[model samples]
Target: MNPCRPEEPPTVGVEEEYFLVHPGSRAVVPASARVVARASAALGEDVAGEFTEFQVEGRTQPCSGARELRAELCRVRTALADAARAEGLRLCASGTPVIADADADVSGDRSGDSTLTYISDHPRYRAGVLQYRSMLDDFAVCAFHAHVHLPDRETAVLTCNHLRPWLPLLVAMSANSPYHRGRDTGYAGWRAVIRSRFPCLGPPPYAASLAEHERLATAMAATEAMLDPGMPFWDVRPNPHLPTLEVRAMDVLPDVADTVALTLLIRALVATAASRAAAGDPGPRTGAELLRAAYWRAARDGWPGHGADPLTGRVLPYAVQAQKLVGHVRPALRAYGDEDEVTAFLDRLASRGPGAERQRARMAAEGRLSAVVDGLVRETCPDR
Candidate 1:
């Protein structure tokens, strides 16, 4: 779409993964097939099953503004929650299940004598289980992915370099998974920690051009480190099938307002990057190691804590980084008429903390993980 001109904000879409939880026990249940079937009847292909049977995902159509996106997200999430309720389950938007059966075996004939349960009956997922084996044991984490349309693959690849320095800030702002397997992980976004176990996980490497990006993706696929060229597991990358650069660093947020806020911010970040690239500004050349360190810090600390600036490798408080991000993207946000909504969302987050902190607060107040799951289910699909 003309590569994010100042007058034209890039169209964006979001994909959110959710967990199906038993309402009483608060345990993740393998009910995605039934829940997705019912939800798809109402929401069409926008709702679908994820890699694991206990997880489902909802996708929003490309939207030009925050209001449209928020409506679409609410519609899809409501449909899913209704469907899950119909089947005696609750839809949870947390990054990880509050409680899970850790010893539960992968269900599917592809994994040998295991029963036909847990894993979704997909060829790719089956192959993944066969290949990764034990690595897939605790692989039920969910994430929020935002796709911002770019002019072309080349531009998308270039924009990724520009977007790299801010990945940690995004992680800190969107931290939602604070607990895993019924116990507090002591990290804000434990989902990030879970994802890092994969071969090509974490922040993407700097690429001089689209060709370089393709070469690395192809190599990863050839080595069987990834399921395919499309699955790099990087925090950010040029989406293989879409003409958009996707940000996959954030945990799936329970609050719809937070989701809309993050998506708009992502669009602004991409627009700002693309405009700078057009003006002959080469983006930050942050090293891979420094980026990883910064990512780890964000996952551990969330916000209002210590974080490192990937650009200069300078450790700074997350509050400072958050302010810097808002300042950097303010021009683009204003151009898109999204400054007010985004700013308000950020302020609320600063005042009340992100989903991770809220979830932790619930746990502390009720003295049970079930309370955290209940809070997640409630926030996942608030009344319209």
Candidate 2:
């Protein structure tokens, strides 16, 4: 047994990015600067700016289980919503904005240029835009990020290795962005496709040791290809500032319960992997090409469609894939008192379908993309 292993399960923290849209028009508005300013002033540092001026990100404090995670997520969402309302804008948790009217013109007096208007004015974001150009503009997407605490950097890196094969399953579960720029993108999570354009964003290569991971990062940073160590935006990577593994595969889920469920699933998965690593298991040896294909398949066809089996790379029913994932992490789930919640949530998700399916259904029913936005805003502000 590993003496360094903590008695308690790792704590989970969630970071969610949202779009600030005009309540009536449903168009993404360049109001995040104002909204974040007011929200951060009222809600502390958790409220922050995202890549685009139309987006805001909220984070939760590290929490032990689904109960505390759910409460903290709700509080953060409520705080963001309250602040957005105070600024006369509505906050939405959808992965992509439903509205396509980019020329809506956010400039009141400054510059008077709408093309140069939507990107955030923050220095880091500006640097990203300058470096990536159209790619950054195409990334009006939001995501639900989970941070799972680990004992040390070594364990964090090892957990990422063990966690690789399972990333696509989580992507399928949390696939939320179907509609992009006012039209159906024909993919459950178009955000994945958009984010893939980044040279540093994707599944990480297998590292022989923690030193290998550092060397890869150092090389990437050396090329000036990435802004910093944090710029190598792997689907799962060791957090730059925290002793945690940050999973970025999932789109920004619409429902709070879904978000909490995803968090619990991630926590369980990481715990299971860390346990196995402690027991001398080196994780799966899946090939890089197969892994990339698995993620692409999930992004293209979420739940209710076929998913690549995590272990074998064979096509399987989405339900079957989800079952396999649950089986893999069940022990950790029970340890954290999350077995029931995770199982029930996945079952319901399979039965009713994920947010992408629901969005498509609404678009079909109402015969307008705006209705999808309406549904997303309603789901985002469930308490309202």
Q: Judged by TM-score, which candidate is best?
A: 1
| TM-scores of the models, in the order given | 0.95, 0.93
After best superposition, candidate 1 residue 365: deviation in angstroms? 1.1
Q: Compared with the true structure, what per-residue lDDT tens digits does model 1 show for residues 236-260?
A: 8878778888999999999999899
Candidate 1 least-lDDT 10 residues:
103-112
lDDT of each: 0.86, 0.81
On residues 52-91, what C-alpha lDDT tens digit does candidate 2 reach at each position?
7889999999998888998998888888888888888888
- Worst lDDT window (10 residues) for model 2? 105-114
TM-score (C-alpha, index-matched) for candidate 2: 0.93
